[model samples]
Target: MKRIPRETMVFLLCSTFYRLASGALLVSLTWNILNQESISYFPLALAILCSFIPAFVTPTLIRRLTRKFNGRQMSARFLLGLAILTLVAGACRYDTSALLVTNLFVWLLFLLLEASLDMWFTQVQRGLAPAQVQRLSGATTASSQAALMIGPLLAAGLTPLLGNLGFSMMLTAIFLVVAAICHSAGQPPITSNDTGSDTKAQELPLALFIPMLLVWPTLGAFNFMLPVNVMVQGWSLLELGILDASFGLGMALIGVLVIAGVSGSRLLAFLSGLLTLSAAAASAWLLLPQDLLFRCACLGLLGMAFGGARIQIRAAIAQRLDEAAVGRSVSRANALGTPVLLVVLLIQLGAIATAWALPFLMVMLSIALLMRLALQRSQPHSAAPDATPYS
Candidate 1:
C-alpha cells in the first residue's frame, strides 16, 4: 500500500483540531443558550438553520477563492476569521439579541471552516489512488471522531471555570488560531491523472443515497434534542459530556473497524439503523426517562450508528465517483437533504409533542432498511461475485 504523504497527514491533523474546536463551541453555545432562564428554542433552531446556509453557498465561494489562494491559505484565512468571530460571540454572550446575532455569524464561520477543509481534502484525494483515498478517508474520519471525544470534556471543564461566555470563547479562539497556523503550512499539490475526464464515471448507487440523506438529519435531530433530554434528566455538564464522549468513542471505534474491513458497509448500516431505531423506541416508550446509564447507552448506540453510517456512505461514494466529483457529490447530497433536516428542527422548535419525535425516527429507520433491501435485490449475480461484501 502507498504511504500517505507527510503533508497530507499535517493537513488532516489541522483539520482534526479545527473540528475539535468547532465541536466544543457547538456544545458550549447550545448548552449556554438552553440553560438560559427564558429557554430560547427559536434562536437555537435559527442558529441551526444558519449553519446549513454555507453548505449550499460555500461551494461556489470556494471555487472563486481557490482561484486566488491555494487551499492552505484559504483554510487559514477562514480559521482566523472564525477565531475572531468566536471572540465577538463571547463578548456579546450576555445579551440574547447580540448572542443570537453573534451565534449566527459564528455558525457561518464554522461552516466556512468545514467547507474549506472539505475542499482541501478533496484536493488531497484527487492526488491519491482509489485504495489510498479509501484508507486516508477512513483515517481522517476516525481522527475527527477522536477529536469529538475530547472536545466535550474540554468544553465541560472549561465552561465551569471560564464562565461559559467570554472566557470559553477566548479559549476556543486560541484553538482555532493553532488550527490556522497548522493549516497554513503548505501541502504538495495533487497532480494525479486519475482525476482526468477520461476515467469512467459510474452513476452513484441509489442505495448509498439512503444513508447519505438520513444519517445526517438523524444525527442532527439526536444532537438537537440531547441537551433538553439531559436537562430534563437533571444531569450535570460532566455527565452530559461523558455521554457525548461515549458517542464519539463509538464512532471512532466503529469507523476504524469498518475501514479495516471487519464488516461490510451495508451490513453495518443496517445494524446501525436498527440500533438507532431501538434506542429511539426505548427513549419514546420510556418518555425520555432520567436514568444516566440508560441515556449514556442510548447515546453510545446513536454515535456508533452515526459513525458506521457515515463511513459507509462516504466509502460507497468514493467507490463510485472520481476525486473531482466526490466533493461536489457530497455537497449536493447534503444540500438535497437540508430541507428535511430543517423540517425536523422546525418541528422541534414549534413545541411539537415529544411523542412525535420517535415516530419520525422510526420512519427514517424503515426507509433505510427498505433501501438496503432494494439495493441488494437490484444487484446482478455477476456483480455480486466480484463485489466485496462490505463495499
Candidate 2:
C-alpha cells in the first residue's frame, strides 16, 4: 500500500470540518433556528443564496497568491484567517437581534474556509500522481461524510446541554482551532520544488471556465428539485429523509469500491456517461405518479450515478490542471452553476411549470456531454498525450 501524502491528509481534515458544518448541521441547524423563531428562515435562505460567493473569488485568489506564496503558506494564512473569523462569529451567536448579522458573518467565514481548502487541494493536484486522485478525493469525501454522520449526533447531544446558540458557538470554536493546527502540519507548496522547466501553465480562458461553471449548476438544479418534487407528491419528511440517507449510502458505497479498485481514467469516463444516464432515467421516472418504493430505488440509483460522475470529473480535472487552477476552475463552475440551480428551483417552486421534468432533462444533457467526451477519447485523431486543462 502506498503512503498518502501530507496534502491529502490535510484535505481529509478539512473535509471533516466541512462535513461537520455543511452536511451535519446545515439543514438541521437552519431548522432549529426557524422552529425557535430566533432567526427567520430568510437568513438561512440568504446564506444559501450566497453559498457560491467563495467559489467565484477563490480561484482568482489562488492565482494571485500562489505566485508569491507557496501552497502551504497560502493555506496556512487562509486557515488562520478563517479561524479568527469563525471565533468572532461564534462569540456573537447568542445575539438574537444580531442573528442574521452573525449568521452572515459565519457564512463568510465558511466561504473563506472553503477557499482555503481549495488552495490546499491545489497542492494535492500538483503533488500526487494521476493515479492517486481518486483515492485521495474519495478519502477526502469519506472523511467529510463520516463527519456529517458524527456532526448531527454531536449537535443533537450537545444542543441539550449547550442550547442552540451555544452548540453552534462550540462548533465554531472547534473548527477554527482545529483548522489552524491542521495548516501548521502541512508541507510547503509545489513552488518550492521547481521541475526546472520554465513552462508557465496556460491559464484557462473564460470561455472554457464558463462552460465548466454552467455544467455543475445544471446538475445541481436537478438536485435542488428532488425535495420539492417529493413533497409535491405528498411524501412525508420521514420518507424524504430516509430516501436521502439511502441515496447517500449508495454514493458512499460506490465511492468506497472505486477507491479500493483504484479505478482508472477509461473506467472513470465510462462510468461518468453510464451514471449520468441512470440519473436521467431516475429523474424521468418522477414524471409518473410517485410510488414510495420506486422513488426510493430511483433516489438510490441517482446517488450511485452521482458518485460515479463525481469521481470521474474530479480525476479528469486533476489530470489537466494544477491544484490552484483546479479549485479556481471548480469554483468557477460552481459559482455559475449555483445561480442557475437557484433560478430553476424557483421556477419549480412557481405555478404552471414542468419543473419536475427539469432534472431528467439536465441529466440527459450532461450524459450527452459525457458521451461526446468518451467518443473524443476514442477517436484516432485525438492526441495521445494532449495537456489541455480540459483534456
TM value for model 1: 0.79
Task: Score each candidate by Cα lDDT.
Answer: 0.62, 0.54
Q: Report the C-alpha lDDT of model 1 over 154-264, residue by residue, as the tens digit.
A: 888877777766456666666676666765576655333333464444445445655565654665676667765666667777887887787787777766765685544
Residue 178 in model 1: lDDT: 64
**RMSD (Å) per prediction:** 4.6, 5.0
223-261: candidate 2 lDDT, tens digit per residue: 345444554566543554555555555556657766775
lDDT of 2: 0.54
Task: Score every model by TM-score.
Answer: 0.79, 0.73
In model 2, the Cα lDDT at residue 73 comes to: 58
In model 1, the clashing pairs are 264-390
